[model samples]
Target chain A: MSQDTLFDKVWDLHKVSSLPGGSDQIFIGLHLIHEVTSPQAFGALKDKNLKVKFPERTVATVDHIVPTDNQSRPFKDNLAEQMIETLEKNCLEHKIRFFNIGSGNQGIVHVVAPELGLTQPGMSIACGDSHTSTHGAFGSIAFGIGTSQVRDVLATQTIAMNKLKVRQIWCDNKLSNGVYAKDLVLHIISKLGVKAGVGFAYEFSGPAIDELSMEERMTICNMSIEGGARCGYINPDEKTFSYIKNKLCAPKNEHWDKALTWWKSLKSNENSIYDDVIKLDASKVEPTVTWGITPGQSISINQQIPLLDDLAPNDKLVAKEAYEYMSFKPGQLIKDTPIDVCFIGSCTNGRISDLRVAAKVLKDKKVSKNVKAFVVPGSEKVATEAKQEGIDQIFKDSGFQWREPGCSMCLAMNSDKLIGNQVSASSSNRNFKGRQGSPSGRTLLMSPAMVAAAAINGKVSDVREFIN
Target chain B: MRSKFTPPIGKISNINGQCISLIGNDIDTDRIIPARFLKCVNFDSLGEYVFEDDRKTLKGKHPFDLEENKNSSILVVNSNFGCGSSREHAPQALIRWGIKAILGESFADIFYSNCIAIGIPCFTLPKNSIEEIQKYCHNQFLFLEIDLKKSLAKSKYLNFNLEIKESSRKMFLSGEWDATATLLANTSLVEKKFKELPYIQFCNDN
Candidate 1:
C-alpha cells in the first residue's frame, strides 16, 4: 500500500465511508458530464426518481458529439441535437450549471474545467470521459467513471471504488528542445506497457516533471488513460498555485491565501512510500509517434517499426495485429510515411499553447497540397485566445483550416472523419483502429508541432528538423 | 438480433452458458461499439451495433457474428481486454448481445468496473488457462457452469478456478453491484465529508 503520497492524501480526504462490498465510497468534489455519456446517466437518475444530490458540485458541457464546423443551435445532425438537448433539459431540471456552446466555457470538459479554475488540488474529480485524469495535474485525485457510476455520483455525490495503488514515475532530467510533454508522455506509455497502470495511479515526479508548465503537465496527465492508468498526478507546486490564481472559479483574497497554504502542504512527504517506482531520463526522449493501433506501439521519429521477433512474447500478438491492420512492414521506417490528413486537436493537445506551438511551426510555410490539415482549439476560450494572438491567422496563412472547438475528429462523433483508409498525423491521444471514424482509417499520434511538420511535408517528418 | 434485452438483477451466484472466445489483446471499447454509434441518447440500440466495424471487417467471421457463437453468453477473451475509453456502452452492448459473464486474462480498470456496474461479472484466469479455454472453444462449443461463490467454471472435461476481486465478487453475491443504492446508504457520511473538506470551506465559486 502507498503511504503519505499525494494520491493517498487526497483519497483519504475524500473517502466518505467503506461500503459493505469492501469498496470505499469516495466523494466527488467535481463531477463533469458531457453529452455522450451523461444523457443515459441522467435518464437513469430520472428512472430512479432521484435528483442530483449536490447540483452545485456537478458541471455540464456539450462535447463528444458537437459539430466543430457549425456552432448554431439545432445542429445538422439530428441525433447530436437530440443528445445535446437531452443534456440541456437534464441540467435545467436538476438545477446544475452548464457551459453551453456559446458560453465561452464550452469545449472539452477536461479543458473547460481547468481554464475556469474548477480543478484544484486536494479534490476528487470524476467525469464520464477518460481524459478526466487531466485535472489530476493539479494534485487532485481524479479518474474517469462509466455512466452507471456517473449516475451514482449524480445521486449521492459519491461512488463505490477501490483505491488505486500509487506508482512513482520519477523522471531524472528535463526534456530536450523540440521534445514536448507529448513526446515525454508517449515515451512513458511506450516504456511502461499499456497494462502496467491497470491498478495504479502514476505520480509523475522529479526534475523533469517539475520543469513542465501547468499546461504541459495537463498534457502529460491527460494521456494517463492511454497508459492504462485511470489517474495520474503531479504534486502541487508554485506552478500549480500561480496557474490557479485569478481564474474564474478560484478563491478570492483571504480565501486564496488559505487555499494556497493548504495546496502547499499537499505534496508527498520526503519519505513517502509508493507501491512501485520506475525511473527514467526524460532528456533521452525524442519526438515519439505511434505507428500502430495501440498507443504503446510507438517509436522515436528516426526508428523503424519493430519486428515481431524484437517484441516480448506477451506483446507479439498485438504487434502482429497492428502490423497487419496498419499495413506496414515489420522493418518499415515510420518517418517519411505519407499522411492524407493532419489533425491538431482533442483533449490531448488542443490547448492554446499547443495551438501556438503548431502555429509557430506553420508560420511562413504552406501545408502540402496533398494533405488536408486543420487545427481545432480545445475550447471556445482556447479558440478566442488563438485568434487574439494571431495563431489562427498563422495557421490559415499556412493553408491549415482554423476551426471551432469541441472534440473534432478525435473520436469522430461528428462529420469530421478520415475518409476510407487515409492515414492521418493526429495530435489526439488514441491511435486505435478506426478511432478517427472510417473503419479502415489510420491515426498516427504525435505532438501538435509534429503534426504541423507532417502537414508541411505531407509525410511524417521529424519536428526537430523544423525547430532546429 | 435476439430477444428484447433484459438486464441482470439481484444476487448473481450462478452463470451457465456456452463460451464465445474472442482472441485478442487490448481489444478496446472503441472497437467494441465504435464512436459513430455513440451519437444516441441511450444504449438501447447499442446491442445490434456492437463490434459493428470489426464485424464488418470480418464479414461474419467474428465470434459475435458466427452462427455457433450466436447464443453464447460467456465471453472469453485475452489480456487487457476493453482497454480504452470509459464508455459503459461497451459492456452494455456486450450484455445486450447476450454476454452474461466474461473470463479474461485481465481487464482495464474502468472497463472492469463498468462491467460490474451493469451486472456483467468479469472473471479472470491465468494466461495459459484462458488460452486453453479459447483454443477448446475454437474447435467446438464449450458449455460452462460458473459458480460465483466458488469462483469456479466447470465444463464436461475441464474445470478451472477463476479470479475476481473479492469486493466485486462480494458485490455480485450481495446485489451491491448496482452501486447507486449502496453509495446512497451513507448519505449522512457523504454530507459530513463535504462539510469536513477544507477546500469546501475556503473555495466558494461564483
Candidate 2:
C-alpha cells in the first residue's frame, strides 16, 4: 500500500466509504461508454428497470464496430448496426451525452475524452474499454472495468474497489531520436513482463516522462493495460494544464486558476512513500517490437528472437508456443521478417502526433507492392487535424488509405481484418493470437513510424534507417 | 452445442461442489473466452464458447471437455490467472459454465473484481496449497466445501484457510455484492460531487 503517492491521494479523495471488508466504495468521476461492451450493461439496466443515476457523468460514443470507410446508419454489418443503434437509443433513453458519428466530437472513447477536456487531473475515470487508462495522461486515475461494473457505474456512479499498491517507474532522461513514447512503453512492458503490474498502479515519473507531449503521455498510459497495471499515470504539470486549456469542455477563464491549483496539489509530494520503485534509462530504449503472442515477448528491432536455451525455464514453454503459432524460427533477427499488412491506428498510435511522425517518413516513399498499409486516426478530431496539416495527403500519396476514425483492425470487431495467416505490423496494442480477426493471423506490435518503415519495405525494418 | 446449464445468480457465499483443474498457468481472458465471442448479446450463452478454441485444439481432452468434469463448479489451479483484457465476459463465461469458486495462487485485479461483482468468489491461497488442492481436483473425485464467511476450503484431509478480502467475503455472504442497490440509493452524494467539479457539465436529463 502506498502512503502518499498521487494514486493514493486521488483514491482517497473519491472514496465514498471504507467498507467493512477493507474496500472503498469509490465514486467514478467519469464513465465513458462505447458500442461493444455497453449494450449488455444497458440491457442489464433495462432488466432492472433502473435509470442512469448521474447521466451527467456518463458519456457515450460509437467505436469498436463502426466501419472506418462507411459509417452511415444501418451499417454493412447487421450486428454492428444493431450495436450502434442500441447505444444511440440507450444514450437517448438514459440522457447521457452521445458523441455520434460525424458529430465532430466523435472518436475513440479514450481519444475524444481528453481532447474535449473531459479527462482531467485528480479524477477517477472508468470505461468499458480496456484502454481507459489513456486518460491517466491527464493525471487522472483512469482504468478499465467490465460491462457489469459498467452497469454498476451507470446505475449508481460508484464501484467497490480495493486500493492498489503503487510502483514508481522512474525513467531517466530523453529518448533517442528514433525511439518514441510507444517504443519506451513497449520496452517497459518487455522489461517488466506483462503480469508484473497486476496488483499495482504504475506512477510513470522522471525527466523522460515529464518531457513527453500530452499525446505521447497518453500513448504510454494507454498501453498500461497491456502491462497489466490497473492504471498508469503521470502527475499533472504545466503541459497538462496547457493542453486542457481552451478545449471545448475545459474550465472557463473564471474557474481556470482554481482548477489548476487543485490539479497541482494532487501531485505526489517529494517525501511520498511508495511500495516499490524501478528505474530505466529512456535513452537506452530502441525501436521495439513483439515477436510472440504476448506484449511482453518483444525484442529490439535489430535483435534476434531468443533461442530455447537462451530463455528462462518458465519462458521456454511460451516461446515454443509463440514459435509454433507464429511459424517463426528462433535466433533470427525480427527485422527483415516479411509482413502482409501495415496498420497505423487504434487508441495506442492513431493520434495526430503519431500520424505526423509516420507521414514525415512516408512523404516520398511508395508502399511496397506486397504490403497493404492504411492509417486510421484515433478519432474525427485527429483525422480533421491531420488533414488540415496535409498529413493525410502525404499518406495518401504514399499509397496508404486515409480512412475515418475508429478502432479499425485494432480488434476483429469490424470488417478491417487480417485475412487467413496474414502477418501484420500493427501500431495498435495487443498481438494476441487471433486478435486481428483471422484465426491464424499474426500481429507484430510496433511503433507507427516502424509500421511506416515496414509499409515501405514490405518487411520489418528499423525506423531509424528512414530517419537519417 | 449450448449446454443446458442456467447457473444460479447472486448472494453466493458458500459453495459445495466438485473441483476441476486446468493444465496451465496465466490462462488469459482471451483464452477463457475468445474476442470473437465478445460480440454477442448478454454473456448467458458464452459458456458454450468458453475455451472453445483451446478445447478444439485439445481434441475434447481439455479438462473442461472431459465428461467427468462436466458438472464441476470449482476451478482449481495456477498463478496470475485471468491476467489479460478487462472483458468481464471471462468470468461470465466461467459462471455460465457453472464455475462458482476459483481457488488459485493469485488472480488478476480486474478479473477478480469482475468475479466479486457478480458473486463469483475468487479465493487466493499459497502456491503449495493450490498444488495440493489441484491433485485432488485433477482426480475429479474431490467434492470441496468453500465457506466464504469462514474463509476456508476443505475436502477430505485437505483443509486450508482461504484468503479473500474481508469486504468481498462480507459482500458475498450478506448479499451486498451487487452494489447497484447501494449506489442507486446514494444519488445525492454523487450529484453533489458532480456539481462541485468545475470541469463537469450535465447533459440534459430525459
Best by lDDT: 1
Per-model TM-score of chain A alone?
0.99, 0.99
Count steric clashes of candidate 2.
1
Candidate 1, lDDT over the whole model: 0.93
TM-score for each predicted model, relative to the true structure = 0.99, 0.95
- TM-score for the first chain in candidate 2 comes to 0.99
Output the TM-score of candidate 1.
0.99
Taking the tens digit of each residue's C-alpha lDDT, what string does model 2 give over A37-81? 888898988899988887888988887888888887789988787
For residue A346, give model 2's deviation from the true position in Å.
0.6
lDDT of 1 by residue, A137-253 (tens): 999989999999999999999989999999999998899999999999999999999999999999999999999999999999999999999999999999999999999999889
The DockQ figures for the candidates are 0.87, 0.46
TM-score for the B chain of model 1: 0.98
Q: Against the native chain B, what TM-score does each candidate's chain B reach?
A: 0.98, 0.91
User: Candidate 1, residues B1-206: lDDT per residue as tens digits?
Assistant: 46899998999999999999999999999999999888888899989999999999999998889999888999999999998899999999999899999999999999999999999999999999999999999999999999999999999998999999999999999987899888888999999999999888876768
How far is B142's C-alpha from truth in model 2 (Å)? 3.7
Q: Which lDDT value does model 2 have at B75?
A: 91
